[model samples]
Target: MTDPTYEFSRAITRRPAASITDGLRAEDIGTPDLGRMLASHAHYVETLKKTGAEVIELAPLESYPDAVFVEDTTLCLPQGAVMMRPGAPSRMGEVAEMEPTIRGVYDEVRQIAGPGHIEGGDILVTGREILVGRSDRTDAAGVTELTEIVSDWGHTVREVFTPPGVLHFKTDCSLLDGETILSTKRLDASGCFEGYRVLHVAEGEEAAANSIRFNQFVLAPAGFPRTTEMLRQNGYDVVEIDNVECAKLDGGMSCLSLRF
Candidate 1:
């Protein structure tokens, strides 16, 4: 049986633009190298295609430096797609750019249409519920609006808290399967994942927590060896993609694509 939460038939990704050097970051680690980012991105898209999924590769939008992080623009659920309103002023235009593509894929598409803000990076859909984290990018009003929107589709949204200093909720956690979650120990200490099976990433390898379970494989950032081995011993087919360029801008495995 296919698990709607992690199993997907298609995915959407955008190529990193030359302007990615200007992408938003909490701190300036270094300017992202567009050539290196493109090579790594090609590998990511190739891995997805290997799973027999139709991967939609969108052209780079030079006007939007952060457009490559497409997952922030919309949440693609089994019932429909909901375009998010990003709290970051610079990111608000991304949703409009993603709307037409989302509409083409889903017969039913909804918009937040809010003064509130939410981003797909702050959400995680499990077998029984949808967990939304309150972060700098996702607010209480955004959670409330999302709850009301999905309730009609029979989904229960649980408002949770993102770890302090985290970019997004999923930055410190990810759904591994229907009942299991891969999370950072710091985030798990808050007890947000209670009632669910949790696996902590190896200390200092917390970035691996943002990995994605796509079809039959787990796509993870390449430099986290310990975390990769841990997932491997647990029966996951792991694929590590070079993430150095993206990391310079605070991006990770889950940030690159929108799967459904």
Candidate 2:
């Protein structure tokens, strides 16, 4: 067994010294919004580091001021990164700004041309298979394109549909390590997600359930005590942190950064 090391002291800097790209624009959220967003961003960055994975920060777009811009979405993963064609038209520019930065992180990066639309939020990597949601942000064509790309990289891609109530699959689902899964109870997926069993979280706790699995670690917001307990009950050492500021602006722990 590994040493607990006093649970988790503030030994590591949770805040990121690096900033996002200049192309990222958070104007729809405004100045006060930026402050709140960055506070969560800092906490989010620190969590990524603890996952034992390396992280790269993207600069905000100075011109596109309204991009709810976060680098993780733009920096799509496993092997070569792919820039998404955002579901929200306002966020489309993020694809371009994110491409080069992601390439800087990985040697090979690809793009999904239109006639197909996809959101970064739709990606969930379960072992060697990648599940992409066929949402308004992502179409069947986009899934086909991604399927080919990932298959070329020696990974499998599966397509799932986002139910009406949920915003996106990732907003309600995530891969926990290689076995367990944290998903918002109902998304209407029957056999689309194969190869492994699933664990579901109720809809009421959707926000808490939709967290990113960094390296092998899970992070949570402070407000949901029940959800926190639920994760712990399932044998996950969840690291809770304050993210009230970003939460108000629709930012969850998963929205913070990308882990490759």
Best by TM-score: 1
Q: Which ten residues in a row have the lowest lDDT in candidate 1?
A: 24-33
Local distance difference test, each candidate: 0.94, 0.60
TM-score of model 1 vs. true structure:
0.99
lDDT of 2 by residue, 57-91 (tens): 55555555434335334535445677777766766
State TM-scores per candidate.
Answer: 0.99, 0.78
RMSD of each: 0.6, 6.0
User: Positional deviation of 24 in candidate 2, in angstroms?
Assistant: 14
Give me the candidate number with maximum lDDT: 1
Q: Which residue pairs in model 1 clash with each other?
A: none
Per-residue lDDT tens digits for candidate 1, residues 91-187, read 8999999999999999999999888999999999999999999999999999999999999899999999998899999999998899999999999
lDDT measured at residue 119 in model 1 versus the true structure, 0 to 100: 94
